[model samples]
Target: MLQPKLKSKVRCTDRDIGEVTKVILDPLSHEISHIVVSMNGSGERQIEMAQVQDVMEDRVELRAPASAIAALPLFQRHDYVTTHEVEISHLEDNIDVTPGEVLVPFPDLEKDVKRRTFFMNFTHVIAFLIGLPMAYPILRFLMKPMYMPFDNDWLMVGNVSKIKQDDVGVQFQYMKKVKEAYMPEAEVEKSVWVLKASPEVLDKVYQDKDQEFRDASGRIIWINKKDFPYIAFSGKCPHLGCAFKWRQHKTLGQVFLCPCHLSIYDATGSVLDGPAPRALDALPIRVSAGGDVEIIDMEFKAGVKSQIRII
Candidate 1:
């Protein structure tokens, strides 16, 4: 009469193991026979009910230690870390009929029968040989979301006083190290634009601007005069991930213009007019003691109204 919940945390005598993925049951007796726990990505182990020492406080404890459990015959599932050819073999094993198909479809029983008995067909064997090496990188890319850690690292971009008030805005580019899934870190250059609007200009600019940018109580979203007093935004366009520039026009005076698709943004990083879903991404910045501006360089999910940080 055991009822082990799916995905419950499992542990060994010495250390924590993994979560229960599936509970194998004997249908005739309605008894739990095995607990399938995924140790990590691409590795699973089946724990017999006999080895489960206790199942209290929402955790399954094992009789064996972690090292002992790892050495067990059932724990040595194919991770393919030792070899790449195993991944190609796994890809060729997923040709079974899906449950979504109706009327069982027209049976390719002859071909499927050969695959089930021999584990692979001639075509699959040939494909595995031709594409075995490339499958490793593809598998890493597919599993990136599960492996990559979420982190936000701050880097100083530039000094605020260095950008003249008349310059309107300036773009800063810096090297960023991106950690790839199952790969080493990579150095890539990224850019950000700092909009330099002095308190004098901001006083006149937003004095009579849109009331919608403020709360119902009439407090403006863009504070006129703040410390450091420099506005910074990601130079990437929200729509199509294109590089945008700050350009001044005869009537417009100064605006963030996207040359790729003609999206326009105002001084406070609000969408003025264009097909852009949202405004430019404003960065987190602060001023130093000597009137210098230091910015925490980070990126957000592009083409999204609510800015979600992506680092």
Candidate 2:
């Protein structure tokens, strides 16, 4: 009986040639016919069993010289076919087995199945490793807003003495610290329009004394006490959130105008003309005894009648 081991060194008569990579067997007889040897530098070749002198535990000695084996044809793998798919004429005559006994003549088929399984598992592992790094940044960026705190703290914007009753609207720019997940804390410039109005003017703009500003979920966001003389409006317009300017119009006189659209507002931040959905958004204000104006800077959803706080 000849037992050929894969990866066994193949030694020619002159020198060591290569190693055995595969053993080809006769399907019916279950006997070895050819062995595929992988050469060190010349690639793989098929060697016939007739040239094999002896098969040992770890090596196979050949009767031919190194030059003769080097000239052999290269080994090629054939496509597999199942026994039930093809008809063999002499399969029964060659086998002398008892009745109701099955014979499995192919051992290399199990090795091929195992190789494919290992390849698939290796591919999945590599794919997971590559995808993990790419997905981390996107997940962090999306969840950053959830972990951030809302800007509800009062920030000192300007002095009340500078905003006079004669002025239509005064623009006050202040530096605010912004928080970002991927970057360090940085200061950004923010601005708001301040208007000084009388008691009658404020009452006309805010008609409903019980009117309340709420968010999208119907939760009350803010309610004016009508105590402060200085009214501060958000720089963003309600119609599409464009920056509005306090300008002198030819027909409308002193009004807040948005250059993007023709949305206009009066000194009380009430929508006077154009496509503005509602009055300009207002923020909570506080006046110190020393005349310092502190206001809570906030943002709201645009193009809606309701005042929905965004941040």
Best by lDDT: 2
lDDT of 2 by residue, 1-311 (tens): 34657778999999999888766556667555667789888988878788899988788999999999889877555432223333442443443222122123345655487789999999999998999899999888889876665666789998988876653698888999987656788998888988777777677656636335554455776666664567788989999988889999999899999998999998878898999999998887777899888888888899999887777
Report per-prediction Cα RMSD to one decimal.
21.6, 18.5
Candidate 2: global Cα-lDDT? 0.76
Question: What tens digits encode model 1's per-residue C-alpha lDDT throughout 1-311?
Answer: 24556667888988888887655443334355666777756467877889998876467888999777776556433211111121222321222212121011122454356558666676689898799788989887788766554443456776665676653768877777777665778988888887666666444344544222232244533332343356667768887779888788667768888988888887766677888888777665556677565555556677777766564
Residue 24 displacement in candidate 1 (angstroms): 41
Query: Candidate 2 — worst ten consecutive residues by lDDT sum?
Result: 95-104
- Candidate 2, residue 244: Cα displacement in angstroms equals 1.5
Clash list (residue pairs), candidate 2: none
